[model samples]
Target: MKRFQVFAIIILTGAMLLVASCFWPKDNIVVGERIIRFIPKEEILDFKVKDNTQNVDSVIAMLESRAYGINEKAIRRNSILDESVFSESDYFVNPKSDGGGTALDNFFRYLQKSDSSLIRIGHFGDSQIEGDRITSLLRIMFQDKFGGSGVGYVPLDDVTSPVSYTRSSSPNWVRYTVFHNRSAKGLYCPGGTVFRYRFATPESTRDSIGSNGDTIKIKVPACSYSNATVFLKLFRGYSVAKLWYGKATEPAELKVYNSKTNELLAEVVLDSDDPFNVMKLPLKSNPVTLKFVFTGPSPEIYGLSFDPVVGVQFDNYGLRGHSGDGLLTISSDLLKAELIKLNDKLVILQFGGNVTPYVKNEASLNNIKNSYDRLYQHFRKAMPDASVLVIGVNDVARSVGGTYASYPMVSRIRDAQKEVALKNGCAFFDLYQLMGGENSVLAWNKKGWASRDGHYSDKGREIVVNELYLAIMGEYNKFLIHGTTAGK
Candidate 1:
């Protein structure tokens, strides 16, 4: 009886093992591939191969030839040939194609050329540029290397609930956004006067104030107007106006005196916008502080000019959840306008950070490159004369057999990005290799350059930006001094 029981137990255990084998799932994480979906139709249409580079030997050559010829034909027919499997990231989304070398050199020449008296370099990125981390550092470096001053654009006010700038106050005004989905009741205002009629004071008498550390400025003609005039008034300060009539022989002087104490503050003559005027004011304090006391019928305030130069660099155009879709999504008109505002525009498209987290198959991966094509077209249209660069994904690793291994497919995604840039005449910088080959981010995390698992630490970010800057500067110098070594 004991023997019979033993046999039955063995039989039951074997049956259970068989069932488990049939039903249980296997681990699916691939080691090196990027998380990109290769949409077959889109891939063919976007990554066509060109004929000129048909016989080149390197990986870059083969990839370019295949992409230009195949992608071009596919685009023409409104079709794609992406049979490649999806990988781990979107680094290849909107990869460049064709005219890389010439595109790069021309962009460098543009940067070196000084068009504006005070050149402006606008570096727009997600949170990376926020608080002027990379932008500030880059600005200082560039200004030292090149020449420019004054922080180009500044938020008249900052409204982050957490507060990210140098100084912090309880609450100045409320904040509102046209692009972001949020609204405030207090003295909130959208980015610029962009979304008309949205500016207001929290309460009727509420006031919000901020300061630029050691920087002090006072407007000579506090009360001023321009183009269209509307009734205006000023409080808590002095004002002045100046005028030039048929080129006056001697500079005319007008003075403002305190009615009670009879304190002399400034001397000038009030002038009109229809006629240009220059006014000067003498401030009692070393750091000048004067408020506008205006009673005018003008729509514009003309006399509020400050020194054309200031400190710090800022570029905050990073989109957190975006997948190389930012350029494609921003309106053509708005993008063009912003590009025009930048003195030496440097566009760096960094992606694939999000794509690594989730991806399932090959076809999806190839289709991911289609997004790169969209990005290329959008950028070309938005900033026809701007310098564009691409930063591919860093090395990401996955756990395999009790250890982390670099997935083989990562190379494919890198190739895709390079091909796209080369084809589209844009410059591509390999962040993956720069960060130290496959699984480098893991090392960066170990060095505390990266956060606990993902994301970069302050130090890590600095390192990344420095490398980028060096690479960028190297290219710029090569082009500027060498003179058109590469053909378009």
Candidate 2:
């Protein structure tokens, strides 16, 4: 009888604790504008739209239908020529087909010439390609096939720590960007970020370097490149600069070092008054470091360009947290002149992921499309000869009803991007579908291919980039076969 009474008391205590826990104050977590609270089921459901589930389902269906043409077999194919399946909407050919040839046809013709001139490909994107993830793989593959030797463009003051190269600058260097809390003066060039070294006046002097000098160092990884070119601009007020390239331990001097050994290679001083200058220097071997010492007035630096004398160069112009519209901040004339100088043949714009989270309705979607269309038109104006390829947003997921599901807005953003690309006569790669369409992030996450927060894992990146490479090569192969005929 006493044991039964004790058991009843224990059960009553447990029930009391459960009731008290329900009444306890809950912590609210804010994500974007939504506040999340661990509350009663009724209260949580009340905060969500009544048709949210149906809307997500409808968007998923649409995405699935659109992705039906993604040839999984072609993506997995080993040989480029054997991969033939591709949707017409997957990549739009310029309808006008300048000079009786498509944009890609022209590129292929250039590739066949085997000339000494470089074929530059400018790849601009948001954080998706930051840190040289996708661009680095593409660069290696292209260089391996086409005979290029160095990693392409490396920004001056990069926020995204690039794995391809090591860059460190003195804290005194000032970084300026074209978009998002923009710089107060000077225009941004094709390479989204620029660096400036300002000298402190007598009253503002803080560092021992004084009012006249600063230094920055760039070190290529152990096996990346043997040569590099530093792109600089001497503004009206700036003066001369010196470049020192060599092994990390070697003294800075103009001398020849063994090509296979890491030693001091060479040094040069630029006293030119030209507004823009390209300083090309050879490195002793792969994994060489270059130091720049500015001894006079401040100079505006664009970035470093690294590539071989021949073959294709892929430049990664990745800006974090950017929508495509930031390109508009740069002057059209400057952008055009830079493109012409770079000999850019192909321009890839990968964006829309950053804008997806804010997409709430049709009007918002249209706004994104309109913004992208304007950007596309600007690129066409800037480089009419270049072929533009727009890569759509990747799959992003959000937690809904205690389960992670694909963000419903991602499909709409993808659709808008496709429309913009087609309307602008540019090719479109549906990266969202290539990532396996709606709710595919879950699978990727489960396979350790993507982070729970939605960014791709290293393995996931390889899988997606490989598929993209196949698609690009497939198009190139098609061009190789028909380009000559079309030109005639």
Candidate 3:
């Protein structure tokens, strides 16, 4: 109860600050007209949080541990892949294909072919995916099974980039996103955020409030957003590092150095050839402390991808406090410009938890379906080649009298989500059902896998994503067995 009071006090304090602030965007969290956006930590706060080695090695062990069902020793390869005969977690319902193959045939085929090409899976979601919780495990599993390395596609200024690596940017670097700043003029990367040096124009900003410890920064003007340096501390190194960006108005100096030793690794003069540009650096040494110094002109810095020449890479784009509706504002041209060049295969859309608290009537329910359908059409136009999978809203619990229970409207939203996925020829995964339906979160909380707030704890996420992995592999197994699900 004291923790609740402290949080409430913080909220009240933020609200007071929001009232005084001249300008702020209403993107992510909207609580009774005040923005309750959970801001990402700036690189300056890097020392505050511990990192290095929590993801890769640890996650690999969990994957092989036989957590949910099949044991690695008994299954070897065939038993784990035998979803039809062995696995019980079957919530994935895919979009109908053109009759010859299933919707994910192209994705599965790529996995089967053993190509060295990087298979990109963009996982888009709400706060549930922040801090690279669920997606990190997926990256390690895919990379281990198929072959790949490095965390893929992190925003230039990320609040939840990935705990696997430690990153700090110059405080002058301010972030603009589809949900964050409405007045800022810039296109968003797949992560829903684009960054600029402090020089960029803006009305006002809400920098990470109180997250820097006890002090809430209510007003930060356009000229000076932060004061920090750019450096990446990798727990594990990658052979290839690719930096993605939009056009630069002038040539910029992007020099790479070993942050600890200050030894120059590579130096490059950057100017975009087209609307989108990527600078691939072949690292000879995996420096423990790598620093990036960008000077001169600020490009529309999208994010960086650390991957090998071959295997699968999954990018986590978590847009907090949003229903899936925010995609309507994301420009298709911008998305295509950044993504069209990649060997993109699958796009996972996980959402609807943020919308549960707002459901009051039937109109709100229809809004969910309509917005999703529109977003689907827009996303398809943006990246037409990729297979789309919609993971329905997970179970949401609310306080009733004293104890917590499932919200009455969760099933309605899940139904709408399933409908949208089916209607649009997108694959559907019934996360609500997989979570054991209504009030399952209560049980999850009992097991320390869930909180009353609806987000999954670390242990719970491992199990949640484990099922998702099996479901995808199950389809692949069928593909391997049947050859094709397309019409004859």
Candidate 4:
């Protein structure tokens, strides 16, 4: 009898706990650092095909319509060098704004007159391009068609994974940027970040300069190019710099190795008295690792650019958590100096994704719009000759009632971005609409094209980039045919 009574009490306790768990105060509960949410009991397990098929169909039709006038056979014959194959308009420009010409027109002009000078495109984005995924592919596409050699700008300290190049540095190196580190104050260049290497002890007390300084190794993959130019933008307080190339296990000594044959190519000593210096080295072949050993006062290194004399150089200036507002923080003089050095012809701003989640109402939306306006104005004032292109936010979905749906405020944020672009005489690309509006992320997730809530999978990225390429080339082709006679 006593055993039966104890069993009844145990069942009652279990029932009580289950009932309490189901009746929480909020829909989502915070346990530790993670938010635990209750799933709806009647959630749909299977994917429901939303009625947005027309959106994608319309995009395809637009691409097809743009290809109607071109000679398909001739394009096929010389597709490698032909830009017409990619001509399709996926961008919008304001009807009444006088920045003079379209960004695409400016870029086309640069492409035509790139023999004497190098034309550079600065692609600034957030985590969408963290590992050089999108930027590297774009670089290859541009370089292949535009007759350029060498990888473009690489930051002094790589914060994200690199696809084309491998960079490893000593542990003593420190990174400073305009975004994250509040205490770090100074004039940042167009890249918005810089790296510095300092000795633990005073340089005077160091036993040996080579033994105490930091060493950085950059390995380039094998390719047809046999020469590379290292462009360095230096800040104050730099003395002697040594560059060694070739296969060497030791980091203390400088060894000359053949850049082509991977044999010790050459040894060069650099003096850091100027703000900017370009060091050119002849490589025996591609696939070479260059080691830079520096010892002296700490030097603020902007970036190391490897590029040929004349070609399209796409510089990836991606800052992980920036909302495009940080550009205003950089002094205009410093920003213009770097842009002038690069001969920046086009500036692509890929933001809005980082600022989407916090936009709850009209006030928040206005704040973002104002911030973008300031950023656009800053870029315009700094680079009057350069064109600006703003890419809108991608589709981000959150779980609602156990099913993934687009955030309610995404459209508002995108509209705000469009307003800012129009107001600043900039071109706007609707990434959200291009991805397929309204629950498109859910469809992408269903098809395994999205990795998580909103981030694209490899396949998804390829699709989006292909479309973007078509859009850019399409506009460029229109500019070629119309020759600025038509309104933007």
Which candidate achieves the best lDDT against the true structure? 3
Listed in order, each prediction's TM-score against the native is: 0.51, 0.70, 0.79, 0.73
Q: Which stretches of candidate 2 lie over 4 Å from their true place?
A: 1-100, 200-275, 282-287, 484-488
Model 1 earns a TM-score of 0.51
Ranking by TM-score: 3, 4, 2, 1
- Lowest lDDT 10-residue stretch of candidate 4: 235-244
Residues 31-88, candidate 3: write the lDDT tens digits.
Answer: 7879675333232223432222222343334434654543444333222345444453
Candidate 2 lDDT tens digits, 1-488? 34567679999976775575477556656789998665444443355422222323443344334432244443432234442454223423333354666545555666654356788888898877887778887776776566576667766566767767766655455678776657554456585666655444122323333233443233423222222222222111111122211111222222333333435555444354433445565543433345544433445556666666776778888888888687888778878877887788888898877887888888988888899989988888888766777888888887675466777889889888877776776767777776567776666676677774567778777766666765666566566545432311
What is the C-alpha local distance difference test score of candidate 3?
A: 0.71
lDDT of each: 0.43, 0.62, 0.71, 0.62
Candidate 4 lDDT over residue span 90-191, tens digit each: 454523336555555666777766666678888888878765667777776676656566667677565776665766665556667777763264645575
State model 2's lDDT.
0.62
| 1-488: candidate 1 lDDT, tens digit per residue | 24567679999976675565455444433548754332233323344322221222242222223321112232211122232211112122222234544555545555545433434344444333444445555654555445444333333223321122222211322223322433221111111111111122233332333262322343333222221111111211112222111122233233444433445545444443322222334534312222322222211111221112322223334434445654454456645654564333556666665565454457756676777767766666666765567777655666543344445466566667667765666667776665555565556655666642335677666666655655555444344444542432
Give lDDT: candidate 1, residue 377. Answer: 64
Runs of candidate 1 with Cα error greater than 4 angstroms are 1-101, 127-130, 150-152, 155-164, 167-314, 341-344, 396-412, 452-454, 485-488
Cα error of candidate 4 at position 127, Å? 0.5
Question: Evaluated with TM-score, which candidate comes out highest?
Answer: 3
